[model samples]
Target: MPTDATAASTEEAATRVVAFFETLAPADVAALGRLYAVDARFKDPFNEVQGVPAIERIFGHMFEALDQPRFVVTGRVVQGPQCFLTWEFLFAFRNFDKGVTQTVRGASHLVFDDQGLVTLHRDYWDAAEELYEKLPLVGGLMRWLKKRANS
Candidate 1:
C-alpha cells in the first residue's frame, strides 16, 4: 500500500541519500543534519557512531583519508516500505594507491521517517573483501590472513 506521502518521502529521501554521498566526500555541513534524525545511529565496518557528532567523527576520518572518496548509486529499489541504495565507492587512499583508482561496490539499507529523515540506516558489505583487501602493503597480508582463517 503506497500512500502519497510514502511515495513522495521515499523519492525525496532517495535523492537526498544520493546527494549526501555525492557531496559527502567533502563533508558538506552546508546541507547536513537535514537528512538524518537528531538521534540517528549509524554503523559501518569502522565504528558504531550515534548522533551528528559521532557521525562527524566517522565521516571525518573518511573525507580526510580518501582522496575524495565518492559514492555513486548504481540503482535504487523501493520495497514495500524500504529503499535499498546500491552504490559504488570510488577513491584513492594510500592503502589502495596503486598509482591508479580503486572502486568498491556496496549497498545501504535505509528506513525513512514521515518527514523523509533517515530513521534507521544500515550498510551491508565486507570491509576486508571490499576495501581492506584492496589496500597497499596490508592488502596482501590481510587477504592471505583472511583466507587462511576462513579455511
Candidate 2:
C-alpha cells in the first residue's frame, strides 16, 4: 500500500520530470542537474550515464543531434516507490527541417526521493526499430538487411 505522502511526492516529481523534458532542446538538458540527485543513475539504449557529470555529457550529445526536442508524457501510474511513465518524444535531426518531427514512444520507471527529485531513471525502448531504422540512409540499409535475413 502507498501512503498519501508517497503518492503526492511522486506526482510532483512526475510534473517536474515532464516539465524538464518539455523544455529540453538539447541545451535545456543542462538544467537536469538541478532536478536529478547528485548520484542519479540514468540509462537508455545507447548509453548508461552515472552521476550528474556523466549524465550531462550524454544530454550534451543528444542535444547536439536534435536542436529542438520535446517529450510528451501521456500516462503515469504510481505504485509505492515506483512510477511507470509513458512518453512520446518529438524531435528532428539538426539537418532536418522543423516540420519533420519523429515521434518515439517509450516508458520510464522513475524512483523519486522524499523531495520529489529523481534518484533513478530507467527507460525502456528499442532504438533499432524506433530510431535507427527510421533514419533515411541508415533506415534503407536496415530494411535491406532485414529483407535479406528474413528471406
Candidate 1 segments exceeding 4 Å error: 25-27, 95-99, 145-151
The lDDT for every candidate, in the order shown, is 0.77, 0.81
Tens digit of per-residue lDDT, candidate 1, span 1-151? 8787787778878887888887674547434578788788788776777786667667677767777678889989875447898989888765445446778888888887777887677887788888778777778999899889999
lDDT of 2 by residue, 15-90 (tens): 7787787677666767887788889899988788779888889878776778566788889898776788999988
For model 1, the run of ten residues with the poorest summed lDDT: 23-32
TM-scores of the candidates are: 0.84, 0.85
